[model samples]
Target: MTSVSIPRRMKGVQIKNFGDAEVLQYKTDLPVGVPGHGEVLVKNEFIGINYVDVYWRRGMMGIPPNGIIGREAEGTVVSTGAGDVNSLKVGDRVVWLAMGGYAEYTIVPASLAYPVPADIKPGVAAAALLQGLFAMSLSHKIVQVKEGNWALVHAAAGGVGLWLCQLLKALGAKTIGTASTAEKMKLAVENGADYVINYEEEKDLVKTIEEVTGGYGVDVVYDGIGKDQTQNNVNVVAKHGTIVTYGAASGFPAPISHATLTAKNIRFVGPAESALMRNIGGGFEKWCAKLFDTIANDKINVVIHDTYSLSEIVRAHKDLEARKTTGKVLAKP
Candidate 1:
């Protein structure tokens, strides 16, 4: 431990009751928690706002009531509890993914805490972990992206959508991104998308994709936006192509059909976050090392759309649900 002044009380957003983002109650008088053995208390510099936070707050996920709602943050370790926690020490700049991140100070298991590169900005570091890994897994692990493959990324200006576009480009693949607004379409193009589809102005999404590919169709479709788009995704993919329905932002997708998958030879699977965590958790240190290298080399860009104070979390969530943000939304306390 160093000579940093530790606070006994902190501010944070807690789920008063699960429903909408309105349920998030920002409390200034919450007690700052002490780190247990092998845990480190982080003075959060920036907390990443993700849709999963919405799921937790909406009763769609299993998080308990009064749970502080967030999964990732970048901060400096202000104190450490007694245990062997590898190379971590007080004052080290690190990124950590753990719940209770919607706060001024968060306690994270030491092993899950990763050191941030000195050159990486705090916002970028805060943006990198879960969303970045999800993008990486889709490219490198879930489906090995090959050179010259054609891909479709829905919600292209969204956090993971931009990452998917950039990483696909790095792998020598082409991406056609679908976005609702012209601003979002331009953002997708800026982030390495080969083509941008303004789905708002377009009527048939499947037709647009087919026309872009000269009727050849895309090799992969990343459908993070669900609802009716799920069925339309099945129609748009090429023969032997793959579809990763990683999320359902619009709502839960229509039930998939085995007959359709068998008929098209399309491999339809969802991004298994928990399974990925189990398999890659042990190798995360190495993955993060490579991620930093890629970032340093400017292989991809990490965009910070907006910043909000912890007290304005309700506003942040409102803006997020309204689709007014692009790339990553960050909050600092």
Candidate 2:
């Protein structure tokens, strides 16, 4: 395996106990991890900040004890571990979907790492990789969206939300997006939402979406804002339509009776993107390729809401949780 001059210590954020953003402890003396079998030691250049990270930090999601608090990052491989690494070698610029990303260095399994093309900037790759693949899985795998299909996307200005807008647009779907503010609504529209609703102002959101679709209701709803919007999703879905609830920004959606779905023949699924990716053969590589290709061809745009230094992670989480961000947020170590 190839190796380089590695450091004994690096900077990272560790969560000893789950609670809130303050639980994330930034330290300069954290040990740099070594790559194990089929793993690569990566020097992270840019780390992606996702809402899911907040869940992990707050104990809403299960993580290993004393775990680091990030899921994805883009970096350069400084060392390779034992065994075949899927043709990856030291010095390869790659993006990975894995745990422990809120660090200057990470041990990434080669299977989760994809080489970044020369034209794609590290920050762009970092910003788009996870969310782009997630959006694809939601629109294509979770439910096969067809041309002219109507999709309702909640938090349409968010990381995954914006990507959903672009992907659904590329598929010729009519998208109705809900955002909290005028600026967010504009961003959603620019990303390809056919209709945007300021949910904060629109007292009757269900009625507004129904009107946009001419009383037919949306064919599918991508709901990231759970709990508060859960019942509303059931109310606005068309007959036989699907609702993919992937995140719980507003808290996990309340459980529903099976009969509620049966009443409209609606399908409710809430698969995490990691599970969805693993279920399909070569899913990681396939979606990563699709994401990079689309970006290369100008088929999609990567919006960066902000970039924070690793030390500023707490403020970053606060911004995200407060709905102060419109697109992907990145952190540089």
Once fitted onto the true fold, the runs of candidate 1 whose alpha carbons sit more than 4 angstroms away are 64-66
Local distance difference test values of all predictions, in order: 0.86, 0.91
lDDT of 2 by residue, 1-333 (tens): 555788999999999999878998999998987789999988999999999999888888787434897889999999888998888998899999988899999998899999999999769999998898889888888899999999999999999999999999999999999999999999999999999998888999998887888899989999998998998899999999998898899988989789999999999999797686677546688878878999999999899999999999999999999999989999998
- Cα TM-score per model: 0.96, 0.98
Model 2 CA deviation exceeding 4 Å by range? 1-3
- lDDT (10s digit) by residue, model 1, range 1-333: 477888898899888678877799989888888888999999999999998788888988787524787988999999898887767999999998767889999988887788999988668988877888889989888889999999999999999999999999989998999998999999999999999998778888888788889998989989888785887788888999998888878998788789988998989878756467557744767777877888878887998898899889999999888889999999998
Best by TM-score: 2
**Root-mean-square deviation (CA) per prediction:** 1.4, 1.2
